[model samples]
Target: MAFPIRSAVAALCAGLAATLLTTAPARAEKQEHAWTVSAGAHAPRARITLDDSTGTLNLSVTRDGRTVIEPSPVGIVTEQADTSRELRFLHRKNRTVEERYRTKSGKRLDRRVRMHETRLSFATPAGARLDLLVRASADGVAYRYVLPAGHGDVLGETSAFNLPPDARAWLGTYRADNEGQFTEYTAATAPTGEYSDQALFETAGGYTLLAESDLTGTYSGARLAHDNGSGTYRVKLADARVKTDGPLTTPWRAMVTGDLATVTRSTFTDDLAPASKVADTSWIKPGTVLWTWLAGGRPAGQSLAAQKAYVDYAAERNWPYEAVDAGWYFKTDAWDTTDPDWQTDSWMPELTAYARAKGVGIIVWIHQRELDTPEERAQWLPTLERWGVKGVKIDFMDSEAQPTLKWYDAVLADTAAHHLMVDFHGSTIPKGIQRTWPHVMTLEGVAGEEKRNNTAAHLTTLPFTRNVIGSMDFTPGAFQRVGLRPNSDAAEAGLAVAYESGLQMFAGTPESYDARPLARDFLDQLPAAWDDTRLLAGRPGQEAVLARRSGDRWFLGGVYAGAARTAEVPLTIGSGRWLVETIEDGTGGLVRNRKVLRGGDTLTVDVVAGGGFAGIACPWRPGVTTCHR
Candidate 1:
């Protein structure tokens, strides 16, 4: 009697009618401290500048000779019941993590630690110390100080204090496969404040940056009953997608909500508007396809037999821009090639001039960490812009907390001001930023071609979750990698035709593009941009199919997994010419670039293997064969 037929219909008709979604919140804490305008012990090392008129808490931290603003966090922590068993457990966790919290007798107290479970982080540099200039306000306790740059790497550590008793604080998902501090809304049991193992995610890099925020803090309880949790911040292993040349700090922890919420990276400083106003963005054109030039290696003139091969390739393909990704500027394989030593004028000037001659633009990579500093950009931005460089690809920018987000927001505004286009690699999924600032051409939010090494199911599931937010330059479509390995899940032609983004780069070696039969055929007719998009079905990293409308044409893409179910997708035009490219059951096949004019324009195809399918829906070009089957 427990058949899916009756159970599903019953759930749909009654329980599953709401469109609400819940998200998790960040970890926050506050302690009250009495304050006086009078400066006393240690005289508050940095200036505590609070402009009550503008509601900004700004403090400058300094060491040796460097200074940085410790921007006031957007929200103050709301008090939680310390008497609660959970609070006691969390306190026990900290006792061990904090080295300073020992007994005055100079002995470790109780040989036990409290609050050790949810320890966010405690950062103290050698020879540098916590200079807490505390103030009590109706809002909350205001603690401000600086982390001097030269304090022996400025060690900061944060552990999300969790205890065995608090394990239920998380939600459950099929991924990660653990019982951790997550809030899952998709499960029927609806364990409040509990996060299943899959609910947690992590990202780390050169800045020694680490962020830990409980996701359940973002979503509402009612919504937390599905999709496990609302917002996602998962651990990324290989795709060291970002490189930084300076220290990067993350202040914003994860927060979630049910409906259309404005994700504010850091909206402090009136610098935003003047930036939008005073900034010159005349050079940017919103709708052009970008190519991540990391197909193989961004070989220098010496590294290649034909020095101009890159420019030639784009010219042949009509690829408007060539992104010298990751290891571009380096003479060696080093990612942070911020050598004031290397002459930028030659490689940049030569490449830019060359690509421009072919009617293509040149975009090179810059470590985001370098941009975080004003001094670095004083020499960096102008140097590259002076060459024929069109824009810069900013890598590894997902410090979704207050401090780091502010840095990125500033970078976007500054890049716009300087007429430089931006692409955020190693980032979170897009959330409509492209609509706001088209200069942000693309972002690497999906498990892109760089991740072809992972299971195809991961690639197949992205359109549902990641693509739903916005554009993903998934570094896609390598026809040959799949040929080499049977399980490549290389929907090379289909995704290039289907995924909706102004920036779509085919990330495969030139050898792969030339040798692979379908790769050539697809890129040959690739358009610059799409006019409209339609979400066919599915969610991120699960299963999804999307349809995009380009001028006088349309593209239908399918990313499939699970059981092979027939999806009866009826078309509005019902009568058109479709140039279909499909991946059926892990096999390479195409439906010919032929015309199909049918009165009943419906597509019912067998979808199997954690793979994909895609096609262009448009009027067949004259002289093309008719595919009226």
Candidate 2:
């Protein structure tokens, strides 16, 4: 069910397993000077301890008897110094709450949350007060500072995670385009803005995913910067300052700890975000997009005629959108026309009109630098609206500073007013903004297929890492393989099911996909957005098995690392005979098969070295013929 911001909590309660729980009494065996909160059943028995005297918080998983987070002081930092040292803890209260909600558009269908919530109230020496709200779940823990009625400027947050000496971290490099690769660091030490906000930590017992969530465009974004000398990772704020007048709440600082599947499957990011801002979301449409820049060069790259050709291709394949990438407004080549002004771009309106006639919509490209002037927007935005452009791919937003974020908010608000969908390229990773504004479809935050040297291992690991927090625009479905690339067809086909993006941009020319009839048939039936998503099996950088449902059909995909392997994946489908159409790597092309199986049947698939597999399942009906290739 859809929920507005004002009705979020109430709507959540309607689907919760029980009523709002009352506060529980302090435990008799509690440690001195420490208040403890533990998670519920079905989740690992995790405990979070808060030191009343020093305001230090530590997290531990009791099942494995390991401290996930060492004692770390938590509070905001100002220009003067660390504010945590000056605060004195007053008292604390606890409650138990459960919430069940399904995403309107996302990877998972629904989430059942049972958390132990704690509110630790504290006051500064000068009488100013704030509450550190902590919520502990079976799979993870999150805490945020809640300011009450009054506060000064906040330079940054002092929240830090002190790890053990032997801990290792999977460090994701920071890029203005948000398309850098992840690397393993023994002792991660990076300057501010050098690492992405989310990172993976490997402990003796299991994996821990660290990230910031529910940003809500309030405070500046924050990443973790490690100090190798002290073995601590501190909160690195995007900007040097952010001012709050009266009441303001900070973003949720979260850490999900468990096995690979459990850690990657956590939805704490969406849980902490506010409800949808768009009330009537029937206008938002997510579907496949055919881009011309990947196939054509700049200067009329996706020009009028080029875009028309792609429009015909999209219509022929039943795809919904065709995007005009960079170089649309201005001519970049000597052979093209010399028109740079949008007001006089007669070809744009002509292309949009022609695309509309063909039942295919147009997505235009815009450089953020071109929209820097507010006065220019008076003329720029209306022309696209008049031309009936379905969306805009905004690019080259190279900073995550407060000013940039504020600018993004303005752009989104204006575009929403004009009913234009958005895809952000050359930007920071998404921090659950899609939950707030459904119009914002996907972000280019991973080392996607756009990079020339992107490998199969990168594709396999993405499902468990970057794709977990938000939608990813990997731009999959490339017919040609890179040097030494094996099993390209199966891997590319599996991407249709593995990656989650509202606008799934397939990367190929018409001639490329048209050459393979079976592959083209599969692409014709692919869905851009899914009703449900489940990770059947996954191991980071190795392999992943995924199943997604759209309407009455279920799609399964599996991607393997750089080696050949075979595994039997179990399906969770409805009780009935089903028709399964399978595709796997073949000697020359992808091999297709049709089979009749029960709901509980397990299918064993063999993946070629550096390859993958994809299949579809639906309830079998009489008089249905099976096709094999």
Using lDDT, give the best candidate's number: 2
Model 2: per-residue lDDT, tens digit, 209-240?
77777664467878777665455777888778
> Against the hidden reference, what TM-scores do the models get?
0.55, 0.86
Give one digit per residue, the lDDT tens place, for model 1 in 1-629: 66988988988866544422211111112211111221222121223332333423333322222221122222111121111011111111112222111111100111121111112212222222222223211111122222223332212221121111212222333222111112213222343332322231111100001122211111111111122232221222111222222322322222211111110111111111111232334576433343545455554423322435766776777777766765555544442435566554245677677778888887777777767777767666777777767888777654443345447556666676667777677654333344345576667654566542555455554443344334566666655565432132334466664454545666665676776655455565656555445555543344556666556566666665455566554554335555444434334544333335442466655655555565556565566552222
RMSD of 2: 10.8
Question: lDDT of candidate 1?
Answer: 0.41
lDDT per model vs. reference: 0.41, 0.73
Output the lDDT of residue 387, model 1: 79
